[model samples]
Target chain A: MNSPLFFLSYFVLSALVLVTAMAAVSFRNLVHCGLSLAFAFLALGAFYILLGAEFLGFVQILVYVGAVAVLIMFVILLAKPGVEERRWGWRDLVGRFAGVGVSLAVFLALLISVFRSPSLAVKAPEAPVFSIAVLGEKLVTEYVLPLQATGLLLTVAVLAAVIFASQEVTKK
Target chain B: MLEDKSIYPDLREGRRVVRPGGKREAKPLNFPARRPWLTLGLAGAAGVFGALVGVAVLLFLMEWLKPGFLGEGCFLYAALADLDRAPAILLNGFLAYIASFVPVPPILLGILSALIVIGVLIGVFLSLFALTSVVERKVLARIQNRYGPNRVGPCGLLQPVADGVKMLVKEDIVPAGADRVVHFFAPVVMLVPALLVLAILPYGPGLVPMELSVGILFFFAMGATTEVAVFMAGWGSTNKYSLLGAMRAIAQMISYELPLIVSAVAVVMLAGSLSPEKIVETQAGYWAGIVPAWFVFTPWGFAGFLLFFIAAQAESNRSPFDLPEGESELVAGHLTEYSGFKYATFFIAEYVGLFAISGLAVTLFLGGWYAPSPLLAFIPGYIWFFVKLYSLVLLAIWIRGTVPRVRIDQLMEFAWKFLIPMSFVVVVAAAVWHYSGGGFLGWVVCTPLLLVPYLLFGSAFAKKFAPSGRVYRYSQG
Candidate 1:
């Protein structure tokens, strides 16, 4: 079903996604883990680009890699993980195993849903015209209500953050 | 027994050569001297060859492959269909035989063309970067009433080559405590975004490489990642100074980025499209075929241009906003731990970033790649682009030479309290000017709207910082 170049790109991107995701969780250093997470986000953006979601791809990078990743690193630096020896126990081991089991179950469910989807049988258009102008029109006209609601929600959240921060400053 | 002269030791002879007891004048080692002319000539020859080869390939692609094999599928084929030279026709006749056997030749041709374009662009800019460094040094020297680097190849033109060789030959060192992988990756990461933004910048008419619908957004998005690389460099070094420098750099970048984007928003608002090419097109018409109708001619555009210029200076870490690399305080800042070619890579990235930002500014406000007037159209578009670009670069160098670096607090205050607020005003001004149809009445309304805040801010800034009347009361007259 796939052309040679497209198939190659898909394979490479999926491999990158897996590797970066693994690296994100596996690194001991918080900064390293954060950078790894950023890489994973970048790979996801590349995936979006390959899927012809150009605007979505750029937004993915601009929001996640540019803003969120920087915020993650900042938080990690602020809350320094002190040098301490790990106190391993059966409780910790059991917790780890439980986490792995839950993740595996989720993965299996996702796979099942993907396999069951009817859309996979349908052929996509040879070339799709989903320009930024079309997306903008759709957002404003078709989905204006949801967009405004989301905007209101975000504004309130920001106001709450500012209030909390100001309160801490006043307390000191 | 014969002993190697290189390893001759005092113990074998029972007396040391040039010992403390003996008096001997130290002589210069017979090292091989550099042949500057030879190297320069070779480089010149290579450059000429490269240019000739690039032209030949483009000509071959345009004239030879377009008509029969492409069969109108290739977009450029129709545009170039009229080009039929004797050599080109002969080449096409020969190439047609080979073209018959290839399946989907357009795909292969497209990839090859893309590679060639990218290669040529990189070569051009890299050489331009070398020239810019020399030009900056010479200009700064002239400003300070001194000569700069006049020893190498006719007024130090070959200095970049020499510096490049030195950087290459130097030993690369990484601190024992450093994260080696990230440390190495940092320079690479830093260099990439600087070059990536260059791809979208339209240099001449029909010269855009990859024109995204969200072109400006893509440029800024790439620009944003350079801060991450700065952090990586600082954090990976395992040095506290590096970390501090990185923090300062990120803070500066983040603060200035707001105003930079906002000022650009004014242009984006006026143009009604994000594409650099479209932005340039919007600024196309001339006033009675005399004064070019560039955005900079407008009152709001003037304000936006000024704001964009200052913010861009900070964004690219040019002085008086270069606290990130403040040598007096932070020991080269985020670049403290870098050595050899890694350090050179950071420098290259910095200059490239500067060029890209300057290019964007030109595209947004200065009517990118367009000649100043219709009379100057014969000069060609790309030449006009570089002339404007280098003039901005020279201005940056002049600013670097004349102004002292600002304090970190003052820098932040200037960006947030001054530039950001003023940028918003500029946007409002742009909107006002646009709605009013940009006539005399629009200019009259917008000028005061811009000037009042600017004047107020300037006076307030001066009042806040300048010495008070009661200051130094105890000092004897």
Candidate 2:
């Protein structure tokens, strides 16, 4: 695993992910778009694997592919078989312009920062055995307070969902 | 019609046989009758055959083309102390896994050895599908109670197999207006992740075929894959019922998953590792009655177990949270358009997911691979693991039969209001309790501490947020 080869794989996979993401936003058929999204998610996972982040890769696939994409498709299917848009409308054209402009601007900013500083892109250390043990141990022991905070956040989310759901019901 | 019970012998497509007086007649079996031994034998055989052929193919390729490629895939062998670079072991394992699909007899002894320890997993999977059908039938029958599939096998044990065959033989219909590619791929996409998840699972001690360190995360990821696949199935079918079912499923699974992960975090906290094998090992050892030797015995242990169990059930799309396939309102939910083997895939995937969840529970909370009592850790891990795993499997069947599916909103509220927050509180309390230790009672006392908050302020919460049942009725009218 030369860093050069690693960087090459990363570039290829990242491009694949981008291509898939583009298909997701650009596809005419909603189902096709959902699939494209899943593919992008999966490609991102492959990128994670190449980066030696197997768990992260698994998470990307599991979360985006397993749950989110299916959900979006599911929600879309609830409506009748809507006709596909044949051409870009006024809003579609304006939206794409805004999106691309914003994206390019952000990319240029990042590029400028990288070029000017030339310090952020540090070579990573080769640390082996970043197994579940290391992650779990770090999460519980070193990051205990934050872990506890995550619990609180989850609990608050639950309570909020309950309260909001209840409010919605009572108003009805 | 009354007398001629003699049935078809080929039995591929729902045929029957008749006994004329004294002679023994092979009865008119249902399409998917309880042929447990047969199904197990065949599937197990198939797995072995597939593995052998797969090995031969790889080695053949290596000899023919690339000599070094075979050595690259052997992560385990590479880790071993004195193993040479001969590609046999790696190729053998691959072949055995692939050999699972072939039909061969001479390899039975070797197959048995290969299936060893992990057999309980395959067994648990097959049984989950079998028993869930039985339980669902029994429950539906009890609700209506004329006794459900009892006529088929023992308490209608053979019913799932019958159902499976029947589903397989039935007309394979793809809805005309559906997304052709997604529709075709949905069931497979859903099922492959479900089945693959089993590969990384450590059913008991020495039972895991592949012991990846990121086991829990991998398990969660697999669950997510199934979720996406189900979403695809529902949408691809192009049916209103399925689409609605998929939405409910998505919402419900997403909401419950938060709590589920929180509960799992509790285990990662306690067991101190994410590997399923490590979790089980952490739980081994004793107190007074063999120390109960499971994470379920800690201060928040019982509460965590309950939360994890309920969430796991919900995650797997079982009762009383089977909103994904609200059969009454949504036909077969995500599976409405599926027929034959495609439908069967969904059915078995559900069962496999159920088994996987239970196996994880046993691993995380219930001292997996360790005996019912911690003292029996000496008795080999897979046995204890399967013993408890099977018990949970049975319990799942029992619950399926005994309960009815709830409304979508109610399901979400129950998770949000009752299970999720409670699990979160319990997780923190458990961590604190683990730090400040006494006995099981110290851990158990956290129960009253948590309940007191809800018990006291619950009225205010109740008043502001109307329960789902009332809301459902109000909306319907």
Candidate 3:
């Protein structure tokens, strides 16, 4: 698991994720940005697969790359593609600085938590034999409340979306 | 006729006999026509002889290169000995044997074996694509009362090969204003997911290429990527027709994907595993040693299978749901700007996508590779899988010939108002069936649950969209 090849692949995937993420943010074309975001999502899924969470990895791809990225692309395409590009102004500069500061703060907090965690000091546990059945069981049994809550929230969101869409049609 | 050909009567007669104007008959090759059975026998004999000789030569070369390569206790020998897994075993064993001589790393060997599997899958499916292309045309021709392509080869069997050559030799024209990079990569992007989806399907016992834990999820994820590819193709083409087609495709795919995945969820729930191999295994065996215990035989399974099939049809953009590529309106839709090999690639991708989805339908509902009865169990599983697959493909072709292309609004309404709700019902009924122990009580509970919604949806849709008498506003009765 700790083979040099594994580390090499890990670093490569991380680099891919970072590069794609940067491209996603910086691409001039909205569609290109969406595609780069999808690539980033795909790279993240690969990272999860490397960590042996195959279910999570696949789900990540299914949801993010498949659904979310597609939805983003649809929005970009359907929107006014002829809109003139706006020149960077003082507001944009301030927004960029604020975004960087927030991201740095979040990253530092995560880094601190990881470095100070007792689990990091202890011997790493053996990787569990991963199975979809176990994940399903855990979701239903131990994490039932959280699962139900998430389901309820998603259902509500879907209902709200339907209602909103229907209202638009009715208004038309 | 004599008056018309006053100077060249003999030449005219020869022309009339040789080149008849209408409905020219396909001439059978002379060798086969002379001795049909003998020719067939010889062909079969030659094929077997060639295969055997090829294997013998390969083995001899291997042994000559390294003495005791096929000796007792060798892993290669052990693998090759398994006749049931002959194709896979031979390829893997040969690669492993070569690796053994080369001192390659274990990881490289693993990667090589994986590549071999992928290569084999691609080879098999690409040929299947070729065969399917011709088969589809022939089947469509039959449906439409036409001769189809009888000029290329015997019964136009080699039409795909000829088409491949034509596409290869033809000029690839890209629109001047098109995004060259995206335009170029779109077909490639479209093809990659179609092939990737093929990896997770359990074609037979131990025949899956990848066998990921979340195989079905992986399939859907790969499927989702195609939407982006379609969009790329449309946007990159810089053609209104292409953009419109791509948009329609994405919308249709997104709409149908819900029902498709939802219906599959029923099978996954009932099978109790996301892994296709496990799902197939769970569906093994027959009830009372007679009827195969395929999920499609059950009430929820039947409904789910119907929903899944319909959604899959839409997903693959077959007729009744092929609004994206509606020839009358879109002029090949997203494919308008593509030409030559690029167009051929898109065509291949479409068929391959159809095959993948149909293969999934087989895996989920038709019990993967299981035979219909214990009596038929002697046949290889992959044969059964392909038999079921080809039947579904034929069914698609039949529907394409029979059904008119659906309107965009009707397509959306069907997916959203009918298929999606019906699929949810399937999921619920599946749960009910499972909790009720999947026996007589389960059937009793699930049948009415499925039937009522199906009837309601069908009748309501018919009532809403029923053709009414036209009102003549200008005419005075």
Q: Which candidate is the best by TM-score?
A: 3
State in Å the error of residue B84, model 1: 19
Query: What residue pairs are clashing in model 3?
Result: none
TM-score of chain B of 3: 0.89
List the lowest-lDDT window of 10 residues for candidate 3 chain B. B1-10
My TM-score estimates for the predictions, one after another, are 0.83, 0.69, 0.89
For all the predictions, what are the DockQ values? Answer: 0.54, 0.59, 0.67
Ranked candidates (lDDT, high to low): 3, 1, 2
Native-structure RMSD, model 2? 9.7
Q: What level of docking quality does candidate 2 show?
A: medium
lDDT of 1 by residue, A2-94 (tens): 678999999999999999999888777788888998889888988998888877888898778887898789778877872323786999989
Q: Show model 1 residue runs off by greater than 4 Å.
A: A82-85, A117-120, A140-149, A159-169, B1-104, B467-477
lDDT of model 1 at position B91: 36
What's the CA error at residue B82 for candidate 2, in Å? 22
> What tens-digit string does per-residue lDDT give for candidate 1 at B307-423?
899999998889899998887788878888888899889988988999999999999999887889888876656777888888889899999889988889889889888999999
> Over the full model, what C-alpha lDDT does candidate 1 score relative to the true structure?
0.81
Model 2: CA > 4 A from native: A1-19, A62-84, A88-127, A131-172, B1-124, B127-161, B374-379, B444-447, B451-477
- Per-model lDDT: 0.81, 0.72, 0.85
Instruction: Flag regions of model 3 displaced more than 4 Å.
Output: A81-86, A90-124, A163-169, B1-46, B59-82, B99-102, B470-477
Expressed as tens digits, the lDDT of each residue in B172-235 for candidate 2 is 8999998888899988887887877887767545657777888888888778766677677877
> What TM-score, to 2 decimals, does candidate 3 have?
0.89
